[model samples]
Target chain A: MKVLVIGAAGMVGRKLVAALLAAGQINDKAISSLTLADVVEPSGLGIDIAHTVIATDLSEEGAAASLIAERPDMIFHLAAIVSGEAEADFEKGYRINLDGTRALLESIRLASQSEPYCPRLVFTSSIAVFGEPLPAVIGDEFQQTPLTSYGTQKAICELLLSDYSRRGFVDGVGIRLPTIAVRPGKPNKAASGFFSGIIREPLAGLEAVLPVADTVRHWFASPRAAVGFLLHGAAMDTAQLGSQRNLSMPGLAVTVGEQIAALERVAGPKAVALIRREPDAVIADMVAGWPKAFEAKRARSMGFVGDASFDEIIEIHIADELSGKVAL
Target chain B: MKVLVIGAAGMVGRKLVAALLAAGQINDKAISSLTLADVVEPSGLGIDIAHTVIATDLSEEGAAASLIAERPDMIFHLAAIVSGEAEADFEKGYRINLDGTRALLESIRLASQSEPYCPRLVFTSSIAVFGEPLPAVIGDEFQQTPLTSYGTQKAICELLLSDYSRRGFVDGVGIRLPTIAVRPGKPNKAASGFFSGIIREPLAGLEAVLPVADTVRHWFASPRAAVGFLLHGAAMDTAQLGSQRNLSMPGLAVTVGEQIAALERVAGPKAVALIRREPDAVIADMVAGWPKAFEAKRARSMGFVGDASFDEIIEIHIADELSGKVAL
Candidate 1:
């Protein structure tokens, strides 16, 4: 089996690559070759696998076609501009997020027409698809009324994924992942970056800004669990999905207080105290509209798993990102 | 105020044009000019309004841009291939329905860049946006999982409309019309054409085929009511719509038996006897997945009205299409 990972330079993508290498195979088939693609060449793996890293911008015309010409058995599409960036740069967002995704799908469709090709396509969507006026627990059948440009792009891609899959262009599964907690990297510009920073920073003996109150609740999953979702989605029985190919993945819904308690439990009060309370109304207002929780009954029933608590999430980060060790 | 009707040659479009002519004004402003555009030039309405009819395909490049350059104050986009046609001709369906609508929106957005140009964009969406595994009554916030290619296109367009509106690109309103019953013209190849055919043919003293069972329930509105919806959508205060611009319009939900009863009540048993029972498994299966009813609480609260009952629908057909007379 061959695998193609788009956005392979990103944090999740790098972790997913590591996970794939660790397993050595998917669905009992040895991954003979791997193609890691992004706008910049991904590096630092240094693994003994037949892999090629390519710097490619999919938004450019003919780029997607050229990439799909290789015809990997499974394609994990995780390429996208972050939410804050997309909202700030509208044209760039639509060009990269919407047109780029469509170009990829179209390229896949064209490729299938030339030869018998139906690859397992796993797309990473986001909970940003759900916006304000949300229910207490967003159900499996909640409507997607994204309030942000980034969310709109994701929602549109979800629609296309379902349509293309239904039309037999590709065997697609779109998983709307929860915000990755304890994201193993420096703080990014994403409004939800604080979700990870508040944990990652404190664990490294650094102060992290807390923009919102302790009551501010949100959904979360560890990078390891997100990788698990992609793998399971690729290997699972898509026949069980019916026509609705996109699903909101299950995650631990926790408030800031719960997260802090989990931090205290995992790394003691010293780590918890490192979180500096700095109320930023702009970020708070933005976070307020986000999805708090979801009754991801469909994905849960389909066997997609997530971390049970923030403590477990932190543990996964330590194991995966910190080599099972955290700085005191 | 100048008004542009994109699909002015079609059934509802023609009625909408007539309605506009009858009203002479919209939102207390006299319609100074009317531009009617379609694949075929619309004619025979020799009203004393400054109007121009053009045969144009919106899916063609530069067509929408040129039209938007004219800067019509109100743009009613009612053009689309019907459900059956779209399902059969996949590429053409997406080209005209999805790409064409997007082209128009993009053109409007581009036009806005030159100057402050936010026109009232009233788009005609459909009940096809909702598919099977449906609730007894689809509410204001139901997930759009369209089964057919046509439904998929409409659903995608709705998302784009909402996104564009939210971004302040255009003042847009998308009204999802119920199946227009007692259609004036001859039956087309649409799967839902039978809904109008049964009542329309019998009222004309001709035998009409009923493909689906009498128990099969579906939503309905008159051509007049559909015209009313477009006009109302064009003139209504969109600020009240907030971010969710698309809405399922209010309609009468009745079984085919109730429809027949209403037909009999309006035009006597002689007319009802003209209906032929033809069990078409193909159309029956197609009809099975259609929307039966809708809560449409949002649209109702927003003051978009529909016929009270099937009887009112029949009355509308007689009054609007049959010159207030039904063959008895």
Candidate 2:
């Protein structure tokens, strides 16, 4: 089966592609065609399979139509503006996140008119869809009242997913992913980057600043669990989803103190020693508004699993990232 | 105060205008203007107030901008395509519902940028925003999984309302109205028309068909109660609403058997004879998907009230419609 991965150069996108390749679920003997598209040309990941990497911007008028012409059986939609960037530039956020998604859906609709083929659309949503004044554990039935523009965009896309799926133009499933902890590589502009940087930088023997206090709690799922959610979402029976297509994925709820303790346990006290506590008033206020934990019963019932503890998350990061890399 | 009614020629629109006039809310002595806009010219309401009736199609470009240029202090957005019509015509539905609402909001935004005036926008949402397989009583926290195109449009509007309100662009409140029963007119193209028809026709000494079975339940509020909800919503302390601007108004949940019993009690057994039981499979299936009851705790807490029972609904209809024409 042919597969198309949009935003294929991003962190999770790269991991997802690697996981798919390692599984060898599509074809064993002959290499299956894989199309990876991103704004920047993906570089140096040892992708030796029959894959085509296209460097293209999807925001242009005809770009989406061109992308849909390939007619891949499965489409993983992971492209979006990060939370900080979206908040800073409102117009760009709406254009890239909202308009881009709409253009893609419309292109799929127009393409299907030629010959009917409803592909499995896997959309990566975020817990940012939930806003402030939240319950301790947000249920599946909780109303979507997003506080940020990024969250608003995701919530809107969730609605569109349901509508499009109901129309039968595409079999869409939106997974509201938790904040993926222990994110590898250099830190970007995400406001929530500190959640990962606290551990990742320390593991690299570099001092990492903790913006918020150790008391602040937030939900987390390891990158491994995130990839697992995507795979399970792709393999699951859509018949059970019915009209409600968007789901809040399962994850672990841990406070910052708990996270540090886990880091100390997995990476030794020397590694944890690289962490420095510095409270950022702006980030602390923002983090305070986010939901502490979510009741992802629906996702749990659908076979999504997450890290039992923050230590497990750190261990996954160790196995995946620091196994053969320049270790301290 | 100046008032602008977007769909002033519609049934509820006309009633709302009349009620406003009777209450003397529109200051007639000063520069207070009442702008009535519709696809067709309004006629024969016999009001001596300062009013202008304009026949303009809102779907046309620059229509919303021109409408907002007047800068009325109160905007009643009652314009929308009916459920069946929206389901039948996809393009028209999206064009009128989604595009029209956005156009109007953009126009308001443009107007506000030049001046510092934000109008009190009361948008009329519907119970169609909720989908099937609902709990026994759907609360304010129930996720919007719209089963129809019309509901999707309304849900989108609700999202926009919340975001715009949070941004302080407009003081907006979306009131999710329950199905109005005992409509005092001929049947419309809506699938739920039979709900009103069963009561209206029988009360008017004419035979009406009951499409669904007696056990079929539906959530309802009288047209008067709907108007009350709108009035209360318009004047309520929006500061209490915070980020969640839209609210589901309270209504009575009554089954068809209960309605018949109420009819029997009010107009005796003879009037109940006008209701001919004709089981329509299509309507029955449609009815099955609708919400039976709503737990409108938010609206109730905000001081919005409705008819307690179907008997009260029938009595109010009689007192409002046939007070002098057909004495009980």
Kindly list the per-residue Cα lDDT of model 2 for residues A236-280, writing each as its tens digit.
Answer: 888889999999998999999999998888777887788888888
Model 2, span B206-307: residue lDDT tens: 888888899988899998898888877777779999988889989999999999999888888777888899898998998899999999999999999988
Which stretches of candidate 1 lie above 4 Å from their native place?
none
Q: What is the TM-score of chain B in candidate 1?
A: 0.98
TM-score of chain B of 2: 0.96
Local distance difference test, each candidate: 0.91, 0.85
- Using Cα atoms with residue i matched to residue i, what is each candidate's TM-score against the true structure? 0.98, 0.94
True contacts kept of each: 0.65, 0.65
Model 2 clash pairs are none
Colliding pairs, model 1: none
